[model samples]
Target: MMKKYVCQYTIIRFLPYVETGEFANIGILMAAINQPYFGFEVIPSKHHGRITNFFDQLNKDTFRETVKVLRDELERVKDNIDFQTPNTSNYQDVAKMIFENIVANKETIVRYSDPRVLITNDPAKELDKLYKRYVERDFATKPHNDQVLEKGIREILQLNHLNKQFKQAKVGDKRFEVRFPFVKRMDGEPLKIIKPLHLRDKEPTKIREHGGTWWQKFVQLQDLNLLPEKVLVPYVGPLANDDSYDACESIIEKIRGLDIEVVQTSEESRILEFAAE
Candidate 1:
């Protein structure tokens, strides 16, 4: 049923009806109190498709206009209910109420990404570093270009160089933390990365010895479909560089192949594309 809805149409349309308005913010409040999900069809595809067709047949634009009028009327008298509550309340209580309503009505999911090997935290700066290190190198020279470092020191130096580029860009947002979901390797072992392991230039061997906690978290992320419609994949290396560009391209391709819409943002270009079945 869920799959049917996703296949049929992008579900963002219904969101507007429940959205708040300036003079009348009661739609959200009504949705919160009545708990719409309790009575409405849990399988959105079944009910919403019919509702959409009905609205369209009745002239969608006019129907939507009528809905706004009806909402305004409802909002005017919402306070007359028996359980009239005070406006000022605990922010936590309001937050919890909103969260519970949304969680019941919507799918919640987790997203993960690899942290910049050098910078353990903060992604915007790391993204900038990724762009500069790979982009600014002397591409014309043989020894200086495309040379994969053998020793751990060289790799660490490279990562440090990348870090400086990240720092220079001033892209670091203090609020963001890095996380990634791990899919099992071909051998059925969970993916894990240890602190010292990032120094290794090559992809680390998939093993429990690297870090069991990380592996456990990886499994946990996959087990729960906590990640909803909004899927966030973090690119660790760099955005502007050839490698990062290729990585971005490949990821976009894969995501589009699954028919998911995507928007790419960078210092230069902002492009939006959608995947439809």
Candidate 2:
């Protein structure tokens, strides 16, 4: 039987920017009526920056709201007091239901210049495709997250010049938790893990080695914040000749310096068991 969900979506586009016959494309989406609209615009022409920026804000807002709704639904299932039987099969079902709900809720977040510009279809497969497209089109862009993190790190270093302010300020006190990217299953709910564990890494050496083409090699983290309950990050000991020691040491220092408690492990067996569950 075909499954149904309670939400819908819409997508609309403006003409591509033209500069020296070159055109840039930008897409934007707004989630929920109350949240600010956001977007990203591609300016094919230098003079089109205004248009692109407008769309960029719209795109960002839509992405933000999408994340919020997705998280809320995951929590709902996680907190279900009526949950009884929990198993792999049931988990898969709940996961599917959550993905569908994301699709249904897409319309709520997408903001169109024209209210008529909306997309609607069955929540089952279409939602999955929409999410994949959103991730590919927006979140996969490297400069966004990496650049943001870099700037944040720079600020941290600069603030250290003033030991007083640095001590008073916090490092990721509110944002330090490890995040899971896209679509996770709750204890009593069923949702298929759409992406694998390896794809969640900050680096892409493995993806490149796997013969993923240039585009395919570009992996983005699924929303870790969407995971229900606690997050388990599995790490292996650093390689003998690699800079793993420095990287891990730096990470450890940062956490400790920030007074954050994080567990470090090298147990492949335990990691595998948790992922499988």
Tell me the number of clashing residue pairs for each predicted model: 11, 38
lDDT of 1 at 79: 32
Candidate 1 vs. true structure, TM-score: 0.20
Compared with the true structure, what per-residue lDDT tens digits does model 2 show for residues 1-277? 5332333233323322111111111232222221111122221223243433423222444434444543454456544512542443354345434333443542333222322123333433544454445333333443243334334433433454421121221111122222223223435332322111221223333222111211111111122232233233322324445543454444434333432223334343443344445
lDDT of 1 by residue, 36-146 (tens): 111101111222333343222223454355346544533443332213433434432443354343334442111111211231233334434433332221122211211
Error of 1 at 46 (Å): 27
Best candidate (score: lDDT): 2
* Residue 265 Cα positional deviation in candidate 2, in Å, after optimal superposition: 9.5
lDDT of 1 at 28: 19
Residue 40 accuracy (lDDT) in model 2:
24
